[model samples]
Target: MALDSYDLYVVIILVVAVAAYFAKNQFISKPESTGFLSNDSNGGTNSRNILETLQKNNKNALLVYGSQTGTAEDYSNKMSRELSSRFGLKTMVADFADYDWDNFGDIKDDILVFFILATYGEGEPTDNAIEFIEFLDNEADTLSSLRFTVFGLGNSTYEFYNAIGRKVDLKLEEKGAERFAEYGEGDDGKGTLDEDFLSWKDGVFDSLRNNLNFEEKELKYEPSLKIIERDELTTEDKQVSLGEPNKKYINTSVGTDLSKGPFDHTHPYLAPITKIKELFNSKERSCVHVEFDISDSNLKYSTGDHLAVWPQNSNENIEIFLKAFDLNDKKDNVIELKALDSTYHIPFPTPITYEAIIRHHLEISGPVSRQFFLSIAAFAPNEETKTKLTKIANDKSKYAEEITLKKYNIADALLYLSSGEPWTKVPFEFLIENIQHLTPRYYSISSSSMREKSNINITAVVESEIEKDKRIVSGVVTNLLKDIEINKNKSGDKPLVTYDLKGPRSKFENFKLPVHVRRSTFKLPSSSKTPIILVGPGTGVAPLRGFIRERITQLENDVNVGPSLLFYGCRNENEDYLYKDEWKEYSKKLGENFEIVTAFSRADPSKKVYVQHKILENSAKINEFINNGAIIYVCGDAAHMARDVQQAFIKIISNERKIDLEKAADLVRSLKVQNRYQEDVW
Candidate 1:
């Protein structure tokens, strides 16, 4: 059969296209980024090398991090530094959400990659890692050339441990990506996160050395930053930060020009405290409900969201830390910290004073780790102190018994090790390098956004205990809050702890502190008609209060609302029944739609009861709601209450549905997968 000339040409074109497709599969194009980006010390002013096209970069390694709350970020930066310092590899650290992986297939065998990812909230990726997780989940571009390893940070208490890390590893392998080392996992539950990281890192270094013939170098301390003391400038200078969180907050309290900027992690709104009242009627323990006015700031928070309160180190802790480092004399010296390495930057904006850093920006009271102590033991004051420090660091059992069990912070430990002698030999640079930045404490919002959008409420119990020395040990954030509340409610009673709450040279002149709202996945059901069951014991009632308040608001607005059941437990009805009067009012308004199943552990000492026990007493009604498609919520202690509540639900389902324990557990797992079961536990 004779074919037309056009048909023959089409047939030839098809043959050429098929051949080209096979050739392309055999040799995919490499990335366009190849030039090495220089550091600040290297005298080149270029942007981040990782952001530059990857294939064009001469560096053989790239570290990408999916961090929430900065731990993974810290790990990623450390990896970048170590890779460059030891292996002679030009390395760069990048945020997981920062780039598109359209060029993912271009990774070559010689170029290694690393992922330091944190699994947040029940096997879920962090908010920042959401897009990248979806990209990895949906895309199937073959990366036969790629080589990588992963280190996952997770809490072992959760059901799906290190799910993101495991899923990503499997997906990458399926796409033909090879591993350089076995997958690493760090568990916060075992209190071995630091040890796990160190152990995994050592193994990775060995693997890299064996595979790439990488030569190791002596562990020399390289300053990622350079500090400049400004004798000409005072801390009052306009350009100086003075421990203010951001540029807008530099003169917020003093100058009228300083107005509230965008509310974020760096720029917290100095929301004023409006009201404070103690909920518990006991002197040994105190629980207070404090309110904040955010009307002036453009901050918006919904029910179940979290409010982060930026805290200052207690005055006593600050003084002790300064004395340990012998920095008390030069506390007011204004200094600027500049980045010396491209991958490194000061955690906070600088030109801040030593006093400000110590008082408001550093965590001086937190427990010290063994690895951190060993890193600075070489600069100890005397032989005796150095020997003790080294022993504590080297002997794990001794470290746990003597250091960890005592809960001695860096200042406390150093003072004990030095026998109260100030360690003047240790450099100030070493102290700054070792101490971590102060992190804000997050409290669940207790007020309904629907009831009062401009105001925020939180309930916190002051954490104070008398030690053997009769000295009080208090939480860094909660004690400061107690001080503020004392100043507000002056009931002729002095605070259990004191803070230099007038922060940064009295710039925070009033009781006001820095604050920001952290959005949470723990939220009320979108529909008001969705039957919801919540278990919140102690301060866990914080978010559940907001949930109930919202439902009442819905009832007020004439919106159809459904039945809501709350299980709350406390020590005694007369002593710590938090918001007792308000619950009565809510009951009167909602009638049968709302019910409070209470458990007072102290009310009946013979057979102490918990929220889960109360749950058992009302299992039939609870199961009815579950069968009617109710969503379940739990908040409070992850180690105890949350787990107990989960177990209680499994039992109820097994009994009501007449199924086996394992089957009921599977159903509960499915509910979690579908977001019908939610938790906000610490």
Candidate 2:
């Protein structure tokens, strides 16, 4: 058909417009995905299908981690590096939350899977592993072709230690999956987690060598990450992260409402410290009572929930770490980190500075691990220092005396070893790989949600340990809270430690803290009429206080409440007695129904009185309450006090029921199973 001049012009115009639209869409930047790498690029789209990811990436080994505080993830990465570098295996690390479990049976027999699971509170899997655990319980398909091994990280103090790990191992075998190695467990309660892991790893490698005919190569340090120093980007650059947790906080201005929905471990709310006061009167010891305002945000918490506070490293520790690593000069220089291996992932967001990494990302002030010493010895400043480090690492007694007993962190150990010489030869990537990412510290909520619905209260004792040489080892979060207490109260005296209370770019200025609420099963009965016997000594009284307050609030609301008993212990009434006057007020509110048994250990210098002694003193009453369907709640030191309290309860039951000790123990175990006896011990 013949076209006129106007028709021809219209056709050309339409073609030009279409081309312009395509070019604009191509140039626009897309949102970055948070998925990890299965190959050279991130497996964002395919991360949900584990079998496909493994087949597409050509990986023979997969390390899946279910971590709560990043320990399991770190262990998985360590194992992945070792497998890749030492055994020449293609490996990839996967988070339990990222993958689908339906493809487990579809994975080829040649691929090996490693389950690095950490058991959380009360025989539960971690938050990320919850879905996977549910899937394992409900899945009908048998994973007969799967070959796997399990390593669990847990504290032995709990009754269900490494429960998730054991369950996974047993379930996998039940589903016809083959186990290539014996199940391994690490005990943090005994402080032997590092040594246990090393021993277990040796056994696993032996099994691999014998069964799979795998050959081991000479061990060498191979960095999984590539560090790129961005000289052009300064700390002042808007794109750079100077301790900001995520990209959304990169250029966020002060006073902006950054609180969105779905606050959890990954995202935190910048809450303001509404109130602060000292609970102790002693000069040597201090306890702080802090209140955080959650009214402005969508955060909600119950009476016995936990509050997770994300703290930053103090300036003093930051400087020491930077100086020890010879990064003081380049601390402020912006840098970008990229994983060299497809399996590895950068721990934190990149375009960050060394100072920010030290201050906010890596745990620089924790006790140095023997394995870490061995790993970093090759990069020591000189031969003498290397030899010294190697000797200390190899000798258990020497390591205990010099590193553990002295409470030396990485910086402290390095400085003492080299006589203040910087470890310049050590690669930054090695440090990043070896050191663990700083995790949040959880504190028991000490306020009743009924009374103060929008405010969360925390009662924490500032923990400080004095070494043999009189060096003070400070608890990172507690000291940070102390600093906040001092700064807020305008106390002229210097704090035990200093922190940049004005957080990244002053976003956390004016006494603000990065915090989130973690739901806890520890709670009072749904009915106010249910009696509760609380045994808590020292800071263990925190949640107990919440229980008491909840009762008081109920009383004020004209609700009938049952009898309440609190067994509390401390040094003396004049010193470390927490909430002394407040307890009296609470007693007034519930006269004849409330009672408190005090155990002042230091009141009588010759004969110490403790909570267990008081428990025995009220044995008949406790037994009576138990018979009346009262719940027993214990919170305190998990190692000694909790065990002692439990034993005391068993004794009381033995005497009350005229039964044997074993029978009484069974009764207590039944109480636990029935949820009548609860523990919030650490």
Best by lDDT: 2
Q: Write the per-residue lDDT of candidate 1 for residues 1-682, one digit (tens) a residue.
A: 9989999999999999999999996665432211111111221233332335454445678888877666676677667767777788777666655466656677678788998888987888975677788877787488889899999998887888888888888888998999988889999877888788878888889998898689998655555667788888787787676666655555445555433555655567777888878888998898889898888877889889999888778888878888888888889898877766544435565677888778776778887877677766877889998999898888888888888888788888888888988888776655665566676788999999999898999999889887786656789878888888777778777877788767765666667778888889899888899999989999999999999999999999999899999999999999999898999999998899999999999897799899999998888999999988899999888777888889999999999989999999999999998999998887
Question: Please, what is the whole-model Cα lDDT of each candidate in the order they appear?
Answer: 0.79, 0.86
lDDT of 2 by residue, 26-121 (tens): 775343224221112342345566788788778999999998877888788788878887798899988888677776788867999999999997
Clashes found in each candidate (C-alpha, N, C closer than 3 A): 8, 0
Cα miss at 21, model 2 (Å)? Answer: 31
Candidate 1 whole-model C-alpha lDDT, 0 to 1? 0.79
lDDT of 1 at 64: 84
TM-score, cand. 1 vs. native: 0.89
For all predictions, the C-alpha RMSD in Å is: 7.7, 7.3
Worst 10 residues of 2 by lDDT: 35-44
**How far out, in Å, is residue 370 in model 2?**
1.2
Best by TM-score: 2
TM-score for each candidate, following the candidate numbering? 0.89, 0.92
For model 1, give the 10-residue run with minimal summed lDDT: 31-40
**Model 1: runs farther than 4 Å from truth?**
1-60, 79-89, 97-111, 251-261
Count of clashes in candidate 2: 0
Error of 2 at 429 (Å): 1.3
